[model samples]
Each structure stands twice: as structure tokens, then as C-alpha cells.
Target: MDKLKINIAGLELKNPVMTASGTFGYGKEFSDFMDLSKIGGIFVKGTTLHERQGNPYPRMAETPSGMLNAVGLQNKGVDYFVSNIYPEIKDLDTNVIVNVSGSTIEDYAECAERLVGLDKIPAIELNISCPNVKEGGMAFGTCANSAANVVKAVRKVYPKTLIVKLSPNVTDITQIAKAVEGEGADCLSLINTLLGMAIDINKRKPILSTVTGGLSGACVKPVALRMVWQTYNAVNIPIIGMGGISCWEDAIEFILAGSSAIQIGTYNFIDPAISVKVAEGIKEYLDKHNISHVKDLIGQLSV
Candidate 1:
């Protein structure tokens, strides 16, 4: 059998596969379709200090090979998660990472302070790629200074693994990646969702109520892979690369390009068992290639 285990900032994952935030609600939702214990980790929906209703109707729009969403970080507060969700899955066979979002630095810090003591939650992923809010979110992630500030502030309180989730709307992703890496981020997740819009030519109006949304799925793979490769060169910490990853081939590209692990996003919307399929595919490849460990493929690129 192949060695699938890998450590990302001290968190031991059974494999290098995980679900992106916002795509997978709490792990309990998909318990019926697939066994949560079969995968590496679960980065659940973005949680804030309080409950969020998210954006108005039509929060989702389909593109050629991808989809756009303005689902404004709708989630129950972190306290609710600790009280209701944690006790059930704390002993599951996978890592439980909470994806957090906030409207201000203070909000983010406060949330982190609360989660720092909860040993059940092994890690926290800061969701800095949301664009629908009036303040914070993707706005903070686009700039190098602000992006680092949030990570630094959270790092002060969150003693465990801190994964900074980056936005894909930036001009140069390496600048932001280097900034966060310097500020004590334990790991990173890239290419959240590309900024895009859809117009209804007939009514001469936009499709989403918010007028714009974050695009995710197969169409954005190339753009995401480029960003991941660039960031991998820039940062010293591990990267949880994602964006348009739907199959084993996609995951392999990310690993070879320097991603320590890959996150499955939009694929879950279509196939709930996509993560499992991807894990199986990775194993098959390892066996055929005579590889003893998945980590051997990390950054094994041709010159």
C-alpha cells in the first residue's frame, strides 16, 4: 500500500485531499452520501462571530464550465459550531478544520480567540476570499499588507495550525503569498474563486442579485494552477491548493506544481463522492508508477 499520510503544520491528514470551505457545509451533511472518515480533512463553511443570512436570492449562476456564487458566507456562529457540531465529529477518522470569515480585523481576532482553546478543532482556515460583503473578506485578501495583518492578528490567538485562504482576484498572488508566509501563517489555500459576472441581455440586467459572484469549477483550473505554482515558489510553508479541482488528474497537477494538498470545491456540488473518487484515483496512480508515497510527487516537475 502507498503512504498517503502527510503533515500540514502539525495536523496529520490521512491523505492530501480536503474539501474547500463554503462548498462543504458541516461534515454531517454529506455523511449519508460518503463516509467522512474516508478522506483527509474537512474545511467546513466559513463561520463568523455571529450568524449570517448571506446575500439575496440567485446567489448562484452557471458559466461555461464553472459557476458563480455570491452566497455571502452564510453560517452559524463559531460558538454554535462548538456546542452543536464539534461533539459529534471530534472523534471522526479525519481532521476537522473550521473555515472562518469576518467583517473586520477585530471580528476575526475575537473569533480566533474563542477557537484557540477548543482542542477538538485541530485547525482554522481564514476565509479571506469572500467578495459580497461591504467590509473585510476578499478586500483584505487582495492587498499584501492587509492580508498579512489578518493572519498576524489571528496567529496571536490561534496557537494551532493557521491556514490562510487566498483570493484569486489579485494582480500578483506571490506578493500576497509571501506577505502571509512572513506573518506566521502555518499553511495556505489558494485561488478561492475568480471574480466574474453574468448579464441577462434580454432584461438588460445582471443575473445574480449581488450583480457579481466568485467563479469556481473546471473552467478556472488553469488560472488557479498558475497561481499555486507561483505561490509555491514564494512561500516556505505548506499550501492547500484549490480552485477548479474536480478529478485525480487535476489534483496531480497541483501536487507536481508544489501544492502539499488539494481541495475539492465545485465538484462536490455535482458529485458528493468526488473526494473519495479522487483519493482512489491517486492511489491507483501511485501503484502504477511504483511510488511508495504521495509526497514523492510534490514539486516533481520537469524543468
Candidate 2:
């Protein structure tokens, strides 16, 4: 059989297909819908030190090719996750990753420290670039120094793989990527969500309560591909490319652009089975092209 396995930040995934945080709830929600074992990895919703109610209502709006969300990491917090949710999914078939978020550097470190010894949890994806929160979310991610500070602090406590999620609203994504890599980030996930908004002409006001929300879906694919390519060349660390990925073709595009793995988002709301289809589709394409290993396609793009 062709080897489809790939490693990112020391976490070895059976395949490159993964579910994006916020897009995939705590895994239990989708338990009846699909086989969790078939998935390569599952990045659970963003977890914080405390509970979050998220933004006001009207937090979502549909766009032409994508969707906008200002959910603002509305989760039950890490304490409940460890005490309650973790046990239920400790033995799943895939790599279960926690998408950790925080309002401050201490919050991030404290949360990481909490997950250090969990045998079932192998990694945590630091979501430093969430655009929905008004406070500390993307503030630490847009700049290199601030981003490094957060990673440096958490790196000291978090022993497992550290995946830093990056926001697309920046002057140069590579600078941020290199900065985090320098500070010892284990892996990178890019183009978290471009800041975008829509308006209701009849009401003469914004569609979302936050005025603006994160833009994700096929609309952001081209931009995501470019940033992934740039960051891949900028840092030696492997990248977990995501943003607007909805199909196997889109997944292969990320691999060619230099991502060791890919994440599926937004599309989850449309079809819960999309990720399974993507995983199967990728294998079919590889076999058709005589590619023996998925790694062979990484950065194989030709001009």
C-alpha cells in the first residue's frame, strides 16, 4: 500500500486530512455521523481557561462561496474538557488535538500545563490568531514579538507538539511564521480566517452582531495557498495548512504548496462527511498518478 502517513511537529498522522478546530466540535458530537478512527487527526474546538459565552447572536452570515463566524470560542473551558470530555474520547481512532486559546500569556501557559500529562492527548494547537475576540485573540498573533512571547512561555510547559495557528490579517505572514519557529513552535497552521463582513442593504447595517467576522471557505483558498507556500519556505518547521479547504483537490493543493497536512473547515457545516470523502479521494488521486507516498507531493508544485 502507498504510504500516506505524514508527521507534523512530531505528531504522526495516519494521513494528512484533519478537522479544523471550531469546525469540529469535541468529536463526540460527530460520533454517530462518521468513523472517527478513519480520520487522521481531530483538532477540537478552541479551549480556554474559563468558560466563554461567545459573541452576541447573529454571529454567523453566509457569503457567496464561504461563511463568516464570530462565535468567539464559545466553549465550556479546559477544566470540564479534562474532567468530562477527555475521557469519552481518549480512545478514539485518530490523533485528538486541543485547539488552545487564551486572553493572556498566563492563560495560555496555565492551560498548556493542565494538559501536560494526559496520556490520551498528544498535542495542542495554540490558536493565537482567532479574529473574533475583541481582547487578546489575534492581538498576540498579528505581530512577531508578541506571538513569540506567547509561544516561548507555553513551550516551557507544554511537552507535546505545539501547533501555532496564524491569522491572515498581517503585512507579512512569513515574519510571524519565522518568529514563532524561532521561539520553538512545533508546527504551524495558517490563514486562520481573513477578517471580513457583509451588510444587509435593506436594513442599512451589518449582518453579523460583531460588525465583522472571520471569512473562511473556498473564497480564501488562493490566499491560504500563497501564505502556506511562503511560510513553508520561511521556516524549516512543517506546516498544517488550512483555510477554505473543502475537497481532495484542495487538500492536494496544500500539500503541493508545502503543508505536511491539511485541515477542513466551514464545509463541515455543509456536510459532516466531507472529511471522510476528502481522505478517500486523496488516496484515489495518488494511486492514479503512481505516487507511492503522500510526502512525494509535498512542495512538488512546478512552474
Candidate 3:
């Protein structure tokens, strides 16, 4: 039995370490730094039904112990990914999961449907964090009904594993989690960047182009862990916890909270090879504690 191996829904991961969407690019970008197959999976950058220019420049701002990004889900669209990016990553040794985003339910469904034919792609992280333009620009993940509707739509077209990435900007994260699970979401990856902002005192203006952006890094771990633990108790589905996970210890903390898997986001920029290091560290922690398998550690927090 591979000690570190675990299964999320039907998707098997060599370990719980995965690269967060938009942070690890398409896995190819990090090829020069680490062995792609060393980690469990890689969630590629966000993909949409149509090309997105993303937020204007000055979209990123650094804060104390964290950073805020309003880089809008800029991408060349799903068709371009199918035609251009898929072939390049289809043969990597690890799982190549796409992060699907859209402004509407139809866009989400259509974009997800495009990846159904690809043999190498095993799953997609449905990013409901994107604002639903048709619904007055409110994020779909912020509302239980809206979250369910999007997951329900994508579930009908996406036959493979569907992992919904929950937004931290919601009033109650678990409510959205249960709603999506009820609508057929296979797994959940939570605490997507918290809503935050930064101001340039000198310029007397907001640092980011969008005035506010998603806050990530070590600063958001406490909130992410709390939400993961809460959602774990509320839903039966496995949770893929993320947000401010920078090291193996942090990864282990998430596992104990309820994350069957964890993704490394902002920290990836600091260390290109951190994902593999995290996987190795997890294995070491398991050995030190005499834990036979990593799955045994899931949600085992004493509290």
C-alpha cells in the first residue's frame, strides 16, 4: 500500500500535494524547477468559455504577510486550451486538472464540456469564484442556490471528477459546500482567497487596479483551516484545502483539519520546487509519527 496515496471521489492522487490554479500555470512552466510527476496533481491556470483580458495592469498588490490579486481570470479561452495547451500537457506523468471558470452557467457548462474528450485530463476544479455577470456580477460560490445551480449545470455535462473551489468571500462557506455536494460535486477545495484590499498611502489610492482583490499567503491559513474544518463536519465529500499553504507543516495542518489534499498557491512564486518538497515532507512526517498511511491522518484533529 502506498502510504501517501489517497483517492478523492474516483480521482486518485499519489499524494495530497497539488498546485493551485493560476499559481502553477500549466505545469509546463514549472518543469525546469521540479519533476512534474513528483507531486500528486497540478490544477492548471483558469480557463473560460471565451478569452478574458483579465483586470487591467497594477492588478496585484502585496500586503503584510500576504498578497492581493485581482488578475481577473485572464485566459485565451477553452477552445484555445483544447487546441493549443492540452496537447502540450496531455502526456505529463502527473494529473493535469484544469480550473474552469465562467461568467454564466452556460459558459461554465460549455467550457467543462470541452475537456470531456481529453484522455489525459482527469478532473476539473470548478472555480465558482468568478462573478456571475448575468446575476449582477455576484460570485456564484457566494450563494448556496447559485453555487448549486452552477455545479448542477456542470455536473450534467462534466462526467468525470468535479471539484468545486469555494470562495471565502461568502457568509457561510459550509452552506455553499453542502449545496454543491447535493448538486453532485465530487470534492471541494476551499477558502479561495479572502476578499481584501491594500492602499498606497503615498498615492492615496488603492494599490490594486480593482481597488480590492483576493488575499492569499500565510495570512489566510487560519481562516482556510477553520473553513475546511467546518466544511468537513458539514459535508461527506473530501475537501482539498488551500489558501496560504506554504510548507509541509502547513499542508499537514490542513490534512488534520479535513483536507484529503492541499494545493500550494502564492508560495509557489517563492519556491518553484516547493510542491515536491511538501510531498517529501509529508512522507517524512508520516514516518516519524508511525502513521502507516496518509489517509489515516485526514480530519484526525484532536479537537
Candidate 4:
């Protein structure tokens, strides 16, 4: 993993491959398939100030090359994590990052502040761009001012690596990236599922109970790559690229575009070992291309 070492903002990753929040659950679930320590990082499921019931049934639907989810940030709350989950995962070898979400500015800040006491948990990924919830999910992400406000509030409490994940639903993603950057975000993660809807033709109604859900998987790669590239040029901070990355080549395309790291999301459903395979595949790519380090590939794309 020598050549695979990457420093996204201040977090040192063994490699640039990690499981996206929600898709991977806690690091414990995948232990049967792969070593948790081998993962670059684990972005745990979304945690709120209190336990959430999440969205209603029919929250998931399959599409042509992707999947839509209206999971609605379902979790057992931040307190539950600090009390129960933290003790279990604290010993894992990889970086444990909390994906923090809330309904108000205070909710996000308070949740982050609580994790502050956990030494094992080094950072928090602010889920300001979650598209599934109605109250505070995508609301804080669509506008620059709202996005900036969320970051600013959380920045006050979260002392460690502060990564603000962005949404692709905006008219201009780079603007949102720049706004968060101005608010002192250490790193940025792009293109959290795009907002889309599916229909149940048989019933002539929306497939998702919520009418619309966040679209992810292979279908979103192109849009995600474009946004990562645009945001990379727009801001000076590090970027973690996600969306439609099911293979090593897809991961390389993102590094070439400007991603310092990449997250494996929906693809985990297809192959639980996909993250490990992709990690090894990246090393093989470096050896073949004679590239000394993975960081060399970041923003290496030439016009």
C-alpha cells in the first residue's frame, strides 16, 4: 500500500478505496467478506441527533443500470453510536468516519460535537446533500448560502477533518463546492445520489413511496465524474469521488479527473468484495502504467 497512500485533507488513507455511507453499513457487516482494516476508510451510515424511523416502505427500486433509494437517513442516532457502535469499531485498523446528518443547523453541530470525544472516530462527513429527506436533507445543499451555513455551523464544533458531501441536484455544483470550501471545509465529496423517480407501470403509481428517491450506481458515473472535475478546478481542497464506480478503470478515471480518493457505493450490492478488488486493481494499474504513486493520477487528465 506504499504507493496507494493518500492524504485527503488531513485524513491519511491506507489506500483510496472506501465504502460509501449507507451502502456498507457499519464496518462489522463486511468483515465476513474482507478485512475492515484494509479499507481506506469507512463512512458509516447517516447518524442524526435522535433515532430516525427513515422513509416508508417501497423505499428501494431497481433501475436499468442503477438503483434508487429513499432510505431517509435511517439510523439509531448519534448517542447510540457513541455508546454501542463505537466500542465495537474503535479497534478497526482503518479510519472510522461518521456521516452526520440533522434537521437543523444545531442538529448537525451537536451530533458532530458528541463524536468529538471518541478517539477512534477521526472525522465526520456532513450529509448536507442527502436527497431523500424532506425537512433538512437536500434543502441545505441546493443553495450556496444554505450549504455554507451548514458547514459554518458544523465547522464550529467538529475539530477534526471536516468533509462536506455535496449533492448533484444543484444547477451548478461547483458553486456549492466553492461555498462549502469558503466555510472552511477540509475536504469535499461529490454527487451524493441524484434525485430521480421510478414508476410502477402495473399500478400506475410511483415505485418509491416518497415519489422520488436518490439515484445511484453505474448510471450516475458520468455525471459524477463531470462534477468532480469541475469542483476540482473550482476549489483547492481535496475531493473524494463517488458514483457509478464498479471497477478499477472507473476509479482511475475519477483519479485522473481530480479525485484524491473514491468511494464504492451501490456496487457493493453487486459484489461485496468489489472494494477490495478495486483497491488491488488500482495497485496493478499503477504497476502497469509505471506511475510511482496514486496521488500522481489526481487531476492528471489533460485537455
Candidate 5:
């Protein structure tokens, strides 16, 4: 099979398929279904400075082709992850990137500082696009200036690969992409679930308790591809593209659109091993087309 390896920041990945944050809990949960080390990397869940219980009971809602989640960044916090969880998973064969979700700028900075001295963590994914919280959640990513400030604050303390996760809920994603690139962001992950909702007409109530939630799955493929392609043109940093990627064709589209790598989100719920399958499928396509390195196809699309 053809090699499908790529680099994010300076770290090498076996293949370019990874699970998005929040969808895959720490690597432990997925190990039940398939080997934890099969995919390129496991992004794990979104962790903060404190443990979050998540939203109310109705934290998730199902749309026609996607799912909405208001699971408010529920995890055991940074200290616990470093102290308890890190020791257990440090020996895993794949790259372990800790995804950080914060409600304020200080929260993002503190999380980055705590992770910098920890040798086990190879990188940190700044989750600037969570729509559930009221304060500094998606607010930071929606505006270019705020997004740049968050990246700047984290850059001061963290010296490793810093991946800024972008939100799709904006007018011009290129504007925000340029803003973060100017402030020392090492890489970017795009189209983190579009804003959407579902309703129970008979019950006269909203599907999710939060009234609105972030939509992810097969339905969002086109929109996400467009955003990734646009951001790829706006910045030079490597982009980890995601949103509605479920098959090999979808994976090819993301690469042709100029993504250095791709992340699988809602597909994990349907098939726990989707990322692994995608990794193999990409290799097959590359071999059939006589393509060597996967990076050879990035941004090779015709307008």
C-alpha cells in the first residue's frame, strides 16, 4: 500500500486520520472496540482546568444526518489528567495530543503552562469553538481579534505545537484564520461543527436542553470542505480539517482542498473504527493513483 504519512507542526503521523476532540473520550474508551494505537493519533476529549459535569440530561440531540451535542466540555481537569491519566497512557504507541477547552483567556493560558513542562504531551489543541457555554466558549473564535488574543496568550507559555481549533460559526473564516496565524499559531483545525438545532414538534420542546447545539456528521461535508479550502489559501500553517468526513471519498476531498491532516468527529459514534478504516482506504487510493506521499495532493485542486 502507498504511504499516507504527514506532519503536523514537527511531529510525524503514521497516517493522516485522527479522532476529533470531545467525540472520542480518552483512548481508553475506544480500545474496547479496536486497538488504541491503530489510527494516527487519538485527540482524546476536551479537558479544562476543572472537571465539568456537562450540561443537563438532554445534552445531545439527533438531526437527520448529524448529531448535536451540548456536552459542556466534561472532563477531570488538567491537573488530574497530568497526575492520574498521563502516567497510564504515556506508553501508548501513537501521538497523544491533549485538547484544551477554556471559558476565558486565563483558562487557556494556565492550561498551556501546565502542559508545557509535562513531557508526555507532544502537543496541545486549543478548543476555541464550543457553543454550549455562555462566556468565553465560542465567543473567542467568532471574532478575529479575540481568537488572535487567545492564541497569543497561550503561545507565551506553551513552546510546543499549538493547534488552534476554528469554529465554523462565522461570516468569514479566512479573517479568523489569518488572525491566529499572525499570532504564532503552529497549526489550525477547521469547521468544528456548525451551529444547528432540532425540535420535538409534538412535545413543543427543543431537542437539546441547551436549545441550540453544534451540528456534526455526513450532512456537513460540503460546507466544511469549502471552509477548509478557503482557510488553506488564507494561511501557510498546516490545517487539520474535519466536519462530516465519513468515507474515503470525503477524505480525498479534504486532502485536495489542502488539509495537511484530517479529524473524525461524529463518525466515531456510528463506527468506532472509522478512523482506522479511513487510514487504510487513503493508502489504497494513493497506491492506485501512484501517489507517494499524501502531502503531494494538498491544495492540488482546480478552481
Candidate 6:
């Protein structure tokens, strides 16, 4: 048996390590730095139903132990992805998952329906973190009912594995987790960047163009781990934990906390080949502890 292999719904991963969307680009960008097939999967950048210009300049701000990003899910739209990006990444050796985002339920469903015909794409991470313009710009993942509605709509059209990416900005992360699971989400990945901001004391102004952005990196791991553990206990579906995961030890902690898989986000900018290193480190950790398979380590925290 492959010790590191695990299954997320029906999508099989060689290991529990995957590069987070928007961080790893389309996997092709990191091919020269590390073997694309060495890791379990690669979630391409966020794709929307329509093209977006994204936030204005200075949308990114570096923080103390993390960073704030208001990239705004900028992409060339789903149709462009189907026509151009898909062909370029359809043949990679590893699982190529797309991270789908939209401003409305219809947009989410239509975008997901476009990817259904692609043979190489195995799964999609539904990013409910985007603002719902029709609903007064509130994020769909922030409300249980709103989260369920979006997942329910996407589920109707997306027949393959559906992984809902939960937002950390919610009052209760588990509530949203259960809501989506009830609506047919195959898996969950949390806690998407925490709401945060930065200041330029000298200029007496906000750092990011949007004044506030999503906080990520080592600073958010504790919150991510806690949320993952909570959601793991709340829902029966698998959880893909991510936030501040930067190393193998961090990845292992997430697994013990309840993540069947973990994604490396902000840290990817620091080390282009970190995903493969984390995978190797995980295998070594398993060997050292006499753990026969990585699955045995899932939610194995002693509490």
C-alpha cells in the first residue's frame, strides 16, 4: 500500500500536501522549481464566471508574521480557462484542481458547469469567500444559509468532487461547514485568510488599496488549526486544512487536528519547492513514528 496516499471524496491524492490556489498559479509556473507530480495536487488560481480587473494597485501588504492580500480573485474568467489554461495543464502528472469563485449563485453554477467537460480536472474547490454583489456584498461563506445556498446551487451542476472553501471571517466556522456538508459538499478546506488590515504610520494611511485584506502565513495557523479541529468534529466529510501552513511540521499538526489534506499558501512565495519538501517530510515523520500509513494520522491528536 502507498503509505502517503489518501482519498478526498473520489479524488485520490498521492499525499496530503497540495499547493493552495492563487499561491501556486496553474502548477506550470512551479514546474521548473519542483517536480509537479511529486505532490498530491495543485489548485490553480481562482476562476470566475467573468473577467475581473481585481483590486487597485498596492493590493498586497506584508505584515508582521504574515501578509495581507486583497487580490480580489482576479482571473480571465472561466471561459478563457476552458479555452486556454485547461489545455496547458490538462496533462500534468498530478491532480489538477480548479478553485472556482463567483459573485452570485448563478455565476458559481455556470462557472462550475463549464469545467464539467474537462477530462483532466478531477475536482474543484468552491471558493465562497468572494463577495455576493446581489446580497449586499456579504461573503456567501459567512452565513450558514448563504453558504448552503451556494453549495446547493453548485452541487446541482457540478457532478464531480465538490470541495467548499470556508471563510475564516464567519462567526462560527463549523456552522458553515455543516451547512455546506448538508447541501452536498464532498469536502471542506478552511480557514480561508482571516480578515485583517495594516497601516503606514508615516503616511497615515492603510497599506492595502482596499484598507483591509485577507491575512495569511504563520500568524494564522493557530486559528486555522482550531477551526479545522472544530469543523472536523462538526461534520463527517473530510477537511482540507490551510491558512498559515509553511512547513512539514505545520502540515503534520493540521493532519492531527483533522485535516485529511493541507494546502501551502503564502509560504509558497518564500520557497517555490516547499510542497514537495513538505510531502517528503511527512513521509519521513510517518516512518520515524512507525505509522504505517498517513491516513492513520488523521485527527489522531490526543487532545
Point out where model 2 deviates above 4 Å. 130-138
TM-score of 1: 0.96
Task: Give one digit per residue, the lDDT tens place, for model 5 in 1-303.
Answer: 327767789877888889898888788788888876777888878889888888886989888899888887878899999899988888878888999888878888998799888786789999887432545345789989889988999999999999999999899999999999999999999888888888999999998898988899999989999999999998999999999999878888999998989999999999998888898889888889988888898889999
Candidate 1 runs further than 4 Å off: 130-138
Clashes of each: 0, 1, 0, 0, 0, 0
lDDT of 4 at 279: 93
Q: TM-score of every model?
A: 0.96, 0.96, 0.99, 0.97, 0.96, 0.99
lDDT of 2 by residue, 173-258 (tens): 99999999999898899879988999999999999999999999999999999999999889998889998888899999999999
Ten residues in sequence with the least summed lDDT for candidate 1: 129-138
Alpha-carbon RMSD to native, per candidate: 1.7, 1.8, 0.9, 1.6, 1.7, 0.8
lDDT of 6 at 195: 93
The lDDT of each candidate is: 0.87, 0.89, 0.93, 0.91, 0.87, 0.94
Candidate 3 to truth, TM: 0.99
- Compare candidates 1 and 3 on TM-score and give the better one: 3
Question: Residue-wise lDDT of candidate 4 within 123-192, one digit each (tens)?
Answer: 8999887432445345788889888988999898888999999989889999999999999999999879
> Over 4 Å off in model 4, which ranges?
130-138
* Residue-by-residue lDDT tens digits, candidate 1, 73-181: 8877879878887788788678889888888777888988888877878899987764325443348898888888888899888889899999988889999999988
Minimum summed lDDT over a 10-residue window in model 5 is located at: 130-139
Ranking by lDDT: 6, 3, 4, 2, 1, 5
